[model samples]
Target chain A: MNLSPQQQKIIEIVPQGAPSIVEESLFEVRKKIYPRAVTGLFARWRWGMVIFTQLLFYGLCWVPWNDRQAVLFNIVERKFYLFGLVLWPQDVFYLAILLIISAFSLFLFTAVAGRLWCGFACPQTVYTEVFLWIERVFEGDRGARMKLDSGDMSQVKLLRKGGKVLTWALLAAWTGFTFVGYFTPIHELWGEVWNFRLGPWESFWLCFYSAFTYLNAGHMREQVCKYMCPYARFQGVMFDPDTLVITYDTERGDPRGSRKKGIDPRSEGKGDCVDCQICVQVCPTGIDIRDGLQYECIGCAACIDACDQVMEKMNYPKGLIRYSTENALSQHWGWREILRHVVRPRVLIYMGILSIVVSAFLFGLLTKSSLQVNVIRDRGIMGREVEGGLIENVFRLQVMNVSEHYQFYAVKVEGLPGIKLASDHVIELPAESSRVFTFEVRADPESGKPGSNPISFEIESLLGDAEAHEKATFFIPR
Target chain B: MQKWMWILWPSFIIAGVAEGIFFSLVNPQELYFLGDPVHYSAIATYSIGFLAFWMVCACSSFLTWSLQRPAGEVNARG
Candidate 1:
């Protein structure tokens, strides 16, 4: 490829003598990134997602469902309650389906646009942005922060660093509390924390989570996204030429040179770029976008805002750097044409699978039963002869009430003549509780001739108005 | 080498004891020993196992510190 004079100049001006390629040496220290703040449409959109995701994550733990915490995954109780759905261990397949659905959705979105989740909605980016904002408030903007970090440790520096650390610690602690709130009841957990009555395990986990949040978000920051995150490594597999990414338009911005305002740069054989490095200054990863797309770029579009502002000041059209596909940038295709190719067969298939999985999940949730029953026959003994000429078999019945209200279940046995319950037919079961009862089934000796007989046990809840039936075989001596 | 191993060995023993304790607390039904009449022996065995696991992890720190000497030498030369 033949580069234009402007391209040659840009190639020349980009920090000479630094290693332009990545190396495998493990001991290399990372350079600090001091990204200047910028405001634009995409920036606003990123902030909106930050607020939405954080609110849902932090707020959902406090929402009450029935008399218990909503969205609780009680591993100890072996139950997951989400809104009105009570998922027992047997329903774990639904979680697998949910994960598949989420994966397919990610694939579909990545096919359309590259790294949108990483730029906006990822926990690392969102929480890091929040922690940076706090740091900015306590210390100052990028320049002030750089100066403070390099200067001697004075009282002012101490106060600023102390305030920032304290704020970060408080946020990390609150995040940990909210996370534990999903497993333990938030209100009760709060009481325990306030009274210092937390159990050993709870205290350990709270401290562990808080430390992790503090280290990852406040200190590690972009290092986590760059080196530690698996997504950065795997994102290449999801990207295609049609996937939209933030790119610099090298063609229009060639023959670059600095010029005064209102000067005809193109007439003077110069490009419209004016050789301003605003884009590089505003990048969060400290990489020059003009060097082409690198894995370090999270596609936050801060460079686009910075470049557009520079273009506006120079009285030129904006989008010297903008979100564009490789094909569109190289071939100058219209957005609608690019969008048409974005919904290709691969993306459509992913979308179709995601929709089916989501529909199946919703259908399962809507039609789920509020009652369940399990019957276990005693293995120690076979059928026995009672004094009343009734053959008896011992069985244990576990009746679970999944409804919001208490239920009285009437147990009934069928498929044999003269079948009777050993105790009262009705058993009171509390809401969200399972009760195990050992009962005897009595039937005539001639019900089946010296072999196993198929029997059905049915439990009907009066409060929930639901019925559950379980089938088991009653053994007879041959 | 001998000094490093000595520094590492105690941490390994402690880590093993900690892991055993954790597992027994999580699933108490899994612990068993042959010819152990008293249950106290089982408890003591679990405690020792957990302490050994913790010690193993902690002992690895000495190994890491020893390995860093080469990197430090390289930086000093540079």
Candidate 2:
């Protein structure tokens, strides 16, 4: 083969061992990150959060209350049980308020200290940490795991990989089971699992959630935060100069290079950083903090802990990497000044609104009525003339006994002269159940001049102080 | 790849919230589609509703993202 002069020159420029140019794809395949495990205050905090959250998630469903799951969203029964409180479809306003509170709390927390939810508490991070721990038990830590992955497919490698995968699968399955348990009666669901009698939908959800947990935490890891989290994309907008963020003290740590310990770095014209790269090794997201803050940081503070240990060993003051605000980092402010800046106007507004909403939410929960009555006028039927020359109206009443006891309720109709219940005025209702009944109310035709008269149904529970007043319009022929 | 993520992920989150709100107010047992009663159970209805909302939201997001692309790229692709 004859080579052109240009090709010859290219070959000459490229050394014999150097490979030819490789075309890059539009989508970059991820290089796997093997974060070394570290132990420090923040790492312990992360583990603490993992235990607390998982306890709530995996244990809460088994807790019994009123002969049922304490915190169940029983779609089968069309009721949400939160301990003593039962929320029906009509009480969905509470769900909206709950969502609003969540959104506001996110904003408040983000403004105060960035990605606190994502770092220590997020299911994604916590689950990943757990899966990594399991991985460590089988394959070993960062260096060994990396070497094993890079090495030949030996029997040991296969066994370790298989064991890790099996453990992860069991944990993921357990997680998925717990998730489905929230919407179904866990006791019954557990029996169904043992008997192989799980419903199709139940099986589908269990598998779906298992796959989700496995893929998201075990495989995807930081990719979810970097590429897929909606909060990650919008969190920049939530941040101000005073917002506390995981920071690298570039001013203090610049001219970073290695030196012998106990030797003053100033004389050597070097900074506190030993260039050991432990901070980079410990990073889950695999970014150097010295390049300044990036969106990829989940604020996990593994780098901070890693660097602090290095600083301590080097006999220097700690906090080479620390939680600090942009303003504080730039202005070289002390902790006092940083705290003062954190109380900026934006933070105050967030805190103020958060307190208000929290109080309101508590108030709503505390004062929630135990009875619900919906007076829906039956449009299918109109006011009719009964045998006594009286005007009669029909209403479809949906009354819910939101409490935990069977009770008798008396229905009274008013808002017209001598208006009275024409049908059975007393209804027997069971605990936490709703019933639809056709209520008949009659009024003297000459009670008032009326086309559509406003009326109210006064429902009083005979067993307790629970009562409901619902309004409906009664029509009279002109 | 990233463009797809930008469209899908935000819409996915939004769709989840929408499903929660919609199902909370309208019980799946009582839901009717185009004057036809939904025969599926509450769990099935909820799942389908979430998927349908997600599809709608993803379409909206994809359209918005495609429209905002550089005019040269859009025209060249066309």
Candidate 3:
């Protein structure tokens, strides 16, 4: 780990004047990144996830569910219908728990493998990759694209630019439409769009989201990851020396210099690195892997793929730049030690909590009642005495049928003797709708001390499968 | 200050108006609904009041952004 006198001097001067250097803030503006394509294990894995995720997203909206959209977040109706489960607004806590779980999962993943989500599964990464692929197809590869940008305004350049823009715009618009389809029914939304009958809000959001997609994915690209993303900035906190990151094996690769192919590096006392710059060329964020691990490296493993290819060409062993921890490279720790560190207490706890939360959510969904009853006491009148010497309390019952089919529920009162329904006992609730019914409950005055008597209402479905019980207080005069 | 103000003010107004129109159309009935006609007008008044309040908030944010110094200057201060 010894540094040369010149390197030591450079290191000493770096900190002393770093503040003043940074204060100027006028470094060369980063050129647009044209990440060269590479093929390897991780690259294939990334593409696999991209296809899998996109298929699930696009396919789920079209899946049929009992004469309705398969999964609809009917925000207007304050209900979310997902296959068999109907989630009311009151069940929004589940969504909050889901968000918490996702956040913890991010933390856990980041701690284990630095920025794995950013590199692989993040929507930003996935969409940007797609957009870049399209750009490559229409405009050509990285070198061609760079050349096109530098060229004069010609018919050929215009045609390529025009075609790329049109493609990007269409894809971005479709993405936005698909996003809105999650809230509104996709088929119905398509019909509405086709007929030019899209609502004002729908139109606005469609345009807004489309514009954002175009700007962020198509134009902003790596700048979004490098500068704008809060995750990139704060992710440093989650990183440790043991965390797996895309790193250069400086010990093996350094004193890095250009050499002819098939040359013996050991005899020449030269390092294995041929200084081809393929790793930098393939990097989406326009970073040099040889510069050491920085926040900009998303651990995409493009460098690994690039370096592997270079190593193969040179007849050298691969992994000059690979997914490895500092401990692994520095201390030459084995994969077993790395695995032990990865599955430590923090990750285990996150996994345990996530499992419990997911199980509880599933259990709640499974055992949830399809019929719900909510009682609202008439605010105008408290309580009155009937001609039969029975104390009466007026209540409004909002009965909701969360199921797809019709349900008839028989309302019954408990917690007071001789209490009877003033109206018909049986109430029929339509599918996916609430029914308001005003009914009076009769109880003996001496049943309870009088100011407020605790009462429970039980609504049992005539089908006998689903039942819901709600509690309320009934006021009785002294 | 003027350049930043010009950029921020329009965006603020645009976003505010867009969000307002969006939420309004999404739940028009809920926005207008009141228990009774007498209560309806009262609720409408309150809704208008809140709408104005939000618009002002948006404008004030624009102002705040405009009043702030340039990033280079801010960093120099730090």
Top candidate by TM-score: 2
As a whole number from 0 to 100, the lDDT of residue A21 in candidate 3 is: 37
TM per candidate = 0.80, 0.87, 0.83
Off by over 4 Å in 3: A1-28, A379-383, A444-453, A473-478, B1-29, B32-78
Write one digit per residue (lDDT tens) for candidate 3, span B1-78.
Answer: 344434454455456555444543344344543454333332233344445655766676667654665777668876
| DockQ, ranked from best to worst | 2, 3, 1
> Judged by lDDT relative to the true structure, which candidate is superior, 1 or 3?
3
**In model 2 chain A, where is the ten-residue run with the lowest total lDDT?**
A20-29
Model 3 lDDT vs. the true structure? 0.80
Give the per-residue lDDT of model 3 (tens digit) for A1-478: 9988877754344465446533443224668788887799889988988898899877888898899888888655656778777777667666666777788789888888999999888888888889989999888888999899999999999998999899999999998999889877899899999999987777877897899899889987787787656688789888888889888999998788988777788677889898999899999899998999888888788889889988988899998888889888889987888887787777788788888888887787778788877889999889999987888899998888878888888889998877778879998877888889998898889877779888899889999988887888888887
Which ten contiguous residues of candidate 1 chain B have the minimum total lDDT?
B37-46
Query: Any residue pairs clashing in model 2, and if so which?
Result: none
What ranking of all candidate models by TM-score puts the best one first? 2, 3, 1
| TM-score for chain B of each model, two decimals | 0.39, 0.88, 0.37
State each model's C-alpha RMSD to the native.
Answer: 9.8, 9.5, 7.9
Best by DockQ: 2
